[model samples]
Target: MIVVLSAVLLFGANIAQAEEPLYVSVGQTTGNLYGLYTTSNEMWAVATQRCKDLGWKNLVFIKSADVTSEVYDLMYEAVGTAYYWSPIIGMNDLDNEGRWLWNDGTPVSGYTNWGPSQPDNHRKEDCAALEWPFNTWNDIDCGREQPFICFQEPSEYKRSQIDDRLFSIRKFDVEKGTQEMARSGCKKDGFRLAVVDSDAVIAKIEKSINWNSKVGYWVDGTHNCLNADNCEGSTSYVCEDVFPLVLSNSREDYTVGNTIEIECAGSGVSTVNVKWQRQDGVPTDNIWNEPLQKIEPGKATLIIKSATLEDSAKYKCSAANDIFSPSRGYVTSINITVHPEAIKDAMSP
Candidate 1:
């Protein structure tokens, strides 16, 4: 019953086929693949389905200024030097007019580049597009056929469920192996040993397993009942996977006497928690001591009012979600140097 329920909730129904669309690789950033669907021009719904047919969860969702730049470049090159209308992507306001949301149902906030007088939602225009040449976003009718961009992050192992799948579960058995093998085995199959975050997942497993058996199972779970073990030997393990956490637009060099700002954006399964800390300095783990820090759904920004000689140190940004293991959080760092002398050498214009 759970399998049947999950199947219905997780995967999409098969749709009619269309001419193969050309997928041009835009570029890989932080292990994620991005590309444009050049050939076929389809309606908003069709474009969404086209990407799903190819196992890409959605059309590209721009989260930060850096990602926005990358998307603009991809579109510009895809359509040659000429100006085009726009690329049909996942952004839309269909659910609630005037409130644009990504395909994943997250609201658009923090960063946006809309054309002048754009997203006027003209004539019931519900879908969103990235306009070429202008390099801005515009609202368009959902029925208008336009080419779109697709995004994907290939998993390292065999997958029973893709990124689009919701609350799906699977298990694997090693018969006789160490916890490392169990984890590695899951990875080889494109999964991580299950970290039971909910009762629903474990309940499903209980019904299927011989609870009285002598064989031990491995799970990075939270329940006290699942006592921590040496993990030296386990015969069975549960496997689960999500979009791997990736960081972008990080690691820039800065000088002293100038105000400094660094941002770290993240992409992964769900709500990604981002943090910044000094990696090589007196206030190492105490990031709260920083002047200002801003946080959004999947991004974080660290600001320094003015750089000083003492501020010349390495600062690190870390991002993780509920799904990530302790060691698997995405991390990036920046190095700052307080060069007041360089600032003093500046000539007045």
Candidate 2:
């Protein structure tokens, strides 16, 4: 019975292993044996054999499905050990220096494995490596580029079709209610307002009104009337589609203890409400009780006598009216830092 049970367990493990799919090999290049891998969908069997003949170990395979087609194509063109002397390019090494950075210039935190004292800065080495036993990196000289392996895998392509019968209605010249337009416009587009086909148009119109109009109004696209003859002027408008809401001015960043001025602007917008609150940690209830100052119709200013670390948070400005929903609401954040007297004195008064 013990022998039979052991055999059963071994068979089960083999089955599980077989279920795992084999990854594809796309290309091979040489560098400082940086273990970084990328993908392409195609395989190059000849290149794999050549690497084996060259006694190259630690082959890194890149799965094509894991990356964009453009990247895959680049790897496919460079198959074999001939490119071994060339630099092994990874997403983080685009600009070299071994410091992997995102396209946005943000330093990629974590995901680093380096050999102890490996980057020893020997003679200003800038290239990096992914060490074995653990995939870590150490900066090395680019001149020491070595060979690397790449892989690709097949993927499925699934295309979805959308209905083409949908149409859109846009306000051209004046403020129009979004709710009314959505209801009336869907019928002409051969769909209902509830359908997904109308969501884009509805969102566009709502954002426009929310950013542009101070007065709230409802647009019913389902309305069939040619003009405002049947529409309720007090609650709705048959006005032509116009530009969406726009910010009156640019936003400026501030530190604690600094006064801030916020402005909201749009064609039909007037009064705006300004609210300030903390972004994280405990919320303060007394902020509202402080005397709020209004600078002008659609403008407000907050004066911080002496800003504190607790003052760091986000401020919101919303402009609205009865004819339309809040036309525009803008958010700006402030960061506070406690500067030492020496640093503060260094600044020009």
Candidate 3:
């Protein structure tokens, strides 16, 4: 009767509703159409309207499991070739400007987004991936090991586990100086040199030691310019920090009459000294003997009275101060070439 018919209809409707697949709403469209994708873990949905507006043509799912069969094939197909290594898309690569492009040589415009400073070319790493919330792309190195996302065909009962953890370093302002000077600056800030590896730390320390002055001594946390062992345990003020030094407006080749000016500075120290030396000249005993004008607190100017090809050799600048316990120094060598014309001109004058 009527009661029996009502029960049948109600049960049928319940079964129909249960059979309908659940789709995740990524965004939405104006109409009933929902942009959807199914993966082993999650069903994602995007509004049709938003998809159309953003020009997003497809749903990219980062498959967490068995990516080898699904996304890997897509990557190979997209590149029109097979790769020896499994391709992963994620943060580091995205920061480095690595991207996935269609085999037809057109950019896949709407698929990628990236975080700031992402894909920095750290040691030439390149690859790109999409991260969540921001939905941005990060460029990374292919050889680097990291997690990845994968997409799969539609099916019901899919769910996504989003990783909300963000691994990042706090941004801070760095005082500008040479590598040595910068290290001292860091120490002043309660930090040591920002080297990631032991080898780099050793190399930096050794370089600082080798460039120390002959008469200078190392202070606690300061660089001992003189390669003296007696002061290994004794603390004294000396130049040993790694700071960057640059020489401007100096010619590679020098001759009689070529005027050379040298300047140096660092984050912590002020006042730099410039000296000129001849490698193999008449005064072999007086190699470091040239008396030069000292610029107060950071710079010195040295002018070669007359240009001569023999004036070419190594020029040294020793920069030091008492700002940090251990001071710092940097050395740069330039090959000087004196043109014959300048030599002849000097001879005539």
Alpha carbon deviation, residue 300, candidate 3 (Å): 1.7
lDDT of 1 at 305: 82
- Please name the candidate that would achieve the greatest TM-score relative to the true structure: 1
Q: Quick one: how many clashes does candidate 1 have?
A: 3
**Please, what are the lDDT tens digits per residue for candidate 2 over residues 96-158?**
555655323555454433457754667766444333212234554545534434222122110
Candidate 1 lDDT over residue span 239-335, tens digit each: 5545433444443444566778776766533355776766332212231234367887777787778777877776656554444211123344566
Taking all chains together, the TM-score of candidate 2 against the true structure is 0.26
122-196: candidate 3 lDDT, tens digit per residue: 676555444322334555444554333322232321111111000111112432223455345445532333332
Q: Give per-model CA RMSD.
A: 13.9, 21.7, 27.8
TM-score of 3: 0.26
Which of 1 and 2 is the better model by lDDT?
1
Superposed Cα deviation of residue 346, candidate 2 (Å): 5.8
Each prediction's TM-score versus the true structure: 0.41, 0.26, 0.26
Candidate-wise lDDT, in order: 0.57, 0.32, 0.33
Q: Which portions of model 3 miss their true places by more than 4 Å?
A: 1-242, 254-257, 262-268, 271-285, 322-327, 342-349
